[model samples]
Target chain A: MTIATATMTSKQRMLAALDGRLPDRLPVTTHHLMPYFLDKYMNGITDQAFFDYFDMDAYVWTVPHRHDPSQGEYPDPEQGEIGFLESRRVSTDDWRVYWEKLPGYEYQTVRYRFVTPKGTLSMVIQSNEHTAWVAEYLIKNKRDIDLLGEYMTAPKCDVEAVNRTAEEFGERGLVRGHICCFDVFGQPGCWQDAACLMKVEDLIYATYDDPEWVHELLKILQRRKMIYIQSLQGARFDIHELGGGSASSTVISPKIFEKFVAPYDKELIAAAHHAGQRITYHTCGGMMPLLELIADMGPDAMETFTPPGMGADVNLAEAKRRIGDRVCMIGGFDQFHYLIDCAPEDTRAEVRRCFEEAGANGRYILSPSDHFFDADPELIRAFADEARRCSYR
Target chain B: MTDLEDLRQSIIEGDMKSTTSLVESALADGLEPGTILNDGMIAAMTEVGRRFEEGEYFVPEMLIAARAMQAGLKILKPKLVDSGTKPLGTVAIGTVKGDLHDIGKSLVAMMLEGAGFEIMDLGVDVPPEKFVEAIRGGAQVIAMSALLTTTMPNMRATVEAVKQAGLRDQSVIVIGGAPVTQAYANEIGADAYAPDASAAVRVTRSLIS
Candidate 1:
């Protein structure tokens, strides 16, 4: 019997898809909503169309906070640049939310750059809308590390606010959340946090010059994230992304990953799962060397199966055959060459190739291997349109 | 007698303190500055590069080894200059515009410095015009790095701008990064492509030699 035609919220569809259940069709999701799309497409398209255009499940993120409702300039803050957003100044006893609005959408960049006895640190503004995340400082020296460890506060997440937002999104779409990441910086987990808090350059040096100190810093960052994940209990989320792939395999040797990355991330993943969140590990670059290791750590899904041509050397078919049963695969589209200036037919063919390789086990999400900065808008429609055609059901 | 072998071991073990001490001792013991650099320091770094390529060592190992080599060079550079040791060539390096990523470029710069080339790092988010300025400043080879594909085209643009300014032949262009390829280098009319920092040094040495 044919199912009755009815509207499903993006949250409902996405959770169903994550559970390996069929939606009306394939659920196409992006890592982030691009500002370029929002600025150009002003046709009264609601945020839901951000996913609806692709016919994919929509995921809404709401980062909540309770701060003092007052207006004043932050004298000295922790992490990011202050006065650049809509921030109200509060006494030390009160809390505040800092936000900066740009044209379009329900999102704004919220940040408060803090100055401490050690040094300065900043927090990325979390919102329902997509804002560009940028790094304000990279750990450049040992002094910077000491300062970060001493000064940077583990972010205070408003779980009550998040629960309310999730309840609001109930059955409409999926509510997805991640560990509040450092402002326009690296990934949210410990290793990436360390990489961001400390510049990749300085971190490399510290690995040899003072490994013990590095371990301590990573532990602090890891513990902070664990606390955040634990706090995520009972919150509505489909899957939370935790790792950046740059350090996973090709960027650094597996030895470094073993010493610096794997142990901590593996720990975080376990904690997140214990807290009832499905984990999606995002390795944007060459992850072939560490795929088995990453898979063994047991994230529910993995993304951006980069091809060797793109400097991420995963053969999609090989990756699927090897670990397809173990974890859900996301992102196999080639956005670099295929999306920009390629023929529409070529785009269709690429989509078919991804489907054939990753679509076999009913455990893949077809998406661009990573975010595309510039693309022909028609190319995007071809991607979404083709994905719609290749439904598993 | 602090000899080449001892210095080589110092570098190989990444004994920066020893490497520094050995270089001074070698200079005091009347070893020729060029001999110490080529036979001792350079030889050790070349082995480090080989071990890195062979996967016997990783980035941390390579970084420390490079750091140790730098410590040795700090002693050797002034002596070589006083003794009139000419470098292989001059290199100007930078990340392409719109790309702020620089670990790759900085590593390439360090490796080039280790290989005895005078290097001018143009820093990140470098426009094509900055490359032109670097070339006019007497850079013999221009090396461009880009971590993002969106910025990779700037390498080609920089090369074309150099040609337009009539400076292409005077400076060889080399490009390398996570996103760049030898094929990309050829397509963009670059003179060379190095897959990694160690190879970057090798290619730079060959171009100048």
Candidate 2:
């Protein structure tokens, strides 16, 4: 076993591991910025601090869009600040965003109003942790689906902009680019995309009434994503994420997954690998049932391994025993109670348990099964500190 | 043909046509509505819940079974209404403020209704006051669902509001979602937490019982 200090760059270590090569030590990483931590203590620190403070591998997100300002509609807010960054509520079309500052919390609430054909919906958020999710959108009915089919514009790719971001991130850490979902209402492809464009309740009705129309809508979203993947030609992303757990084996029956999900992602993942990129399956729910199925879909890594006690039956030992060699296992820590205000001893013990279960194999990285909100500082320190104690021989 | 054995067989086979037809035939045959409900529909739902928990069934299966149960209820409800068949309890449910996800909430409501609890679905973006009103309207349980960590505090506030209304003891508080856990449930002063829809049925039954 090598006892190493922080000498190798984060990118070198992460890439080495991804290539099935050994690094100096295990690459400790995190999935997201903890909203509670940043708002309360950090006082609005930079996004870079998420990796810097923890001394973990950095995951840089690059979103490249080539928007035609003329074709794109911009709202000039009547009340608050007005800029591309600033927003206001439009009564008619529902796509609106505005920010408000609270007294104690460092972040501001960004409220978004989405006006869809079925009804109007709104979401208020104070942090990225709770970034407003949309419930309804303009594409609610069958005719609205037809409208999106006819008029929805393809997002032009800004390859140079994305490559510039990647160049900057490559010097410090790993640069990861993601596909922008159409709207926050649903999946970027397949059943979830259909659910989001149309309401879930309404979609259920549609599935029975007009199965063929639903199939056409899924095909359109799937095709758009295929075109986007083709655009990712020279972007230097280590891994691109695809497929939400809502389509995982746990959320839907194998029938629905095979019927709607597999047919779509199989094409995409094959396309991505063909384009020389690895895929990460982000299943934030029970994955035990779908582990084999997900592995079959060919994601390079699986994340958010919800512990058995926490709804999803994630037996880390069994997971590693089953599919650890096939792909990297991204998360296993029981963040629900163990990370928040828990005993330091308990936190340390939990970390060791994950290590014993998953770390023995070569493809495990420690992370919270999912993101957590506010947590005790001592527990946070304990997690980082205990993870460092696990050595790779 | 409208007997409990026949109805149970139809449901087990997922013969929605036969199940719907049986309910109509039972009503036409002057069979007791309560018997068709407690003996037939609820029994099928119970079997569905058990199979779901045991992993013998999945979401689509549960959804289809819930659809069949609702169909049976459509036939049985009016007859039960005339015969004065009362529900086991009432539950007020919604996805809390700031969270737009509803698949989890919708599944829980279906499972609760399948268990014979009348559901007062307050829809999504439900503020604290809406929960208070639902409780005041004779809901025995106040259930909050949130898919994000940001909206979790809304669950706590709803629980506190019910307490402020002096209805906390009279009403049991429950919360569930992709991000929710038992520890969060306790920290937020909720009486119970169910990770999934099947467990939700069991948890609600345990709470009200």
Candidate 3:
């Protein structure tokens, strides 16, 4: 009933669906075009070209940020070219990094020491060409968080920089960024950022063993993210994503989500709206249990509804029936099966299936269930082509 | 009798302080270490697993409960050793090479340890040769996990390396993680595929037994 008669630009289509309205067709896009995919398969095509090649509804991401220079902050001198989602190491005199490349490891392992006045906090990390993960967490001791909360510099959003990019890009695609994260490696959501600093198992145990300490840690992270959100007076972002997979039901219980995840993020979601921006709560794991819970947070949209086959529990039809009316739905196609080692027909069928189930009353953007590191280009074309043909009329 | 029941409830509720206290009390009351373990810790993990499979519990709950069980087990382990108790089997577990996602692998290791298996945890980003080393060092089973399809290939590579090392028959290989499936297990020629950590305990028991 909300479908328009004519075709709309990607921005207009996304904005319309984001408002719970339908456009001429489904708004199809992929999340994070992996550099590995672009380098290996497409001869290092630009991310925008990846969108054009598949004809997807594109989102141009921008994160222009700065650190406090008065604190002797500068980019790490010894660091090399930054990879995806990595900013230059924001170094200060109190927060210096000493990296030692350890011998004998399967992947690239580097042990980092952040020297500060209270003492030193160290974390080891490993990375292949594709992704990175924390090996040794920074907050080793219970009170190590004090070093971070006291010394860590929160990145400032360059409002003029964001506004300039939006002006230049015009309507080619929607401009986006996320709530600022913890310094070294973190997600936007407060609890998820805490999970990154502490191992998830330890964090979950703390939620039971020392709930007050868990709150203390989450509060510090929540306050840092709030500093970034409050600075965004007019950033011109089409939608900013909040939440992460650690809060998903597959990883944590509903009780924990209600107790730890929802309260902190609910306030941020409101603050983002107050800044004249739209927010999409991104939980790229089992969303079935937290559907109504996340929806009640009042995000403008929600996403990455990972299916059960991918080891998360998302019943797309049931999800639409439950919260489809409340928020814009994005991402439900299983890229693992349909976009890799499958026929183009399979990909097209999945696009149609998502359209039938969640796209019926509109406000649904058909995307891959979540991010994928490997997939076929032909299947991707079929994915986009079929999505374009899925008319709401 | 009441103390053991309280110990079980503590473990089920993931009460670390009370689980250790109850185990200590049960030991002081002249209960056998094996009896305390079987009646208190393992029984509680069994209920935790049941609740996990039935959707009444989740990863965090399972983790907290496992922590409680481990806490109780720590109190019982020395006494159990003095009483000449033997673990069910030896399990060598890790997240496969190029995959640093270890939370799921850690859960499986803890669950297997709770099930009375002696575990040699190889940690994350583990190469196939380390698993081979564990087997040659007399680990009875090799369990590997990977959370990404990019890294899932390492599972098969590990299976191949075990065959190459001429120790394929010495160890039973169990593969699992987010992107892993039963078909992938079969494709990679692994002995078993467990959907989650709770199922992993049963699968590990069935395979080793």
Alpha-carbon runs more than 4 Å astray in model 2:
A1-3, A34-37, A67-129, A183-189, A201-210, A376-378, B3-6, B9-18, B97-99, B183-190
Query: Any residue pairs clashing in model 2, and if so which?
Result: A94-A113, A94-A115, A116-A137, A187-A192
- Candidate 2: Cα lDDT at A324: 84
State every prediction's TM-score relative to the real structure.
Answer: 0.83, 0.84, 0.94
- Model 3 alpha-carbon miss at residue B150, Å: 0.9
Give the range of the ten consecutive residues with the poorest summed lDDT in model 2 chain A: A83-92
Show where candidate 3 strays beyond 4 Å: A1-6, A67-82, A88-106, A110-120, B1-3
The residue-by-residue lDDT of candidate 1 on B121-179, one tens digit each, is 99977889999999899999999998777678899999899999999889988899877
Better of 1 and 3 by TM-score: 3
Per-residue lDDT for B1-209 in model 3, tens only? 44788998998988889899888889888999988888778888889999999999998888988888998898889999999998988999999988878889999999998888999999987889999999998899999998998989999999999999999988999988877889999998999999899999999999999
RMSD of each: 5.7, 5.3, 2.7
Error of 1 at B107 (Å): 1.0
lDDT of 1 by residue, A222-321 (tens): 8757766777777667677778745756556676777888888888889888988888888877676677877887788888798766666778999998
**Model 1 residue A41 lDDT score:** 51
Residues A286-334, model 3: lDDT tens digits: 8888999999999998999887778778889999999999999989889
Model 1: which docking level applies? Answer: acceptable
* Candidate chain B TM-scores, in order: 0.96, 0.95, 0.97
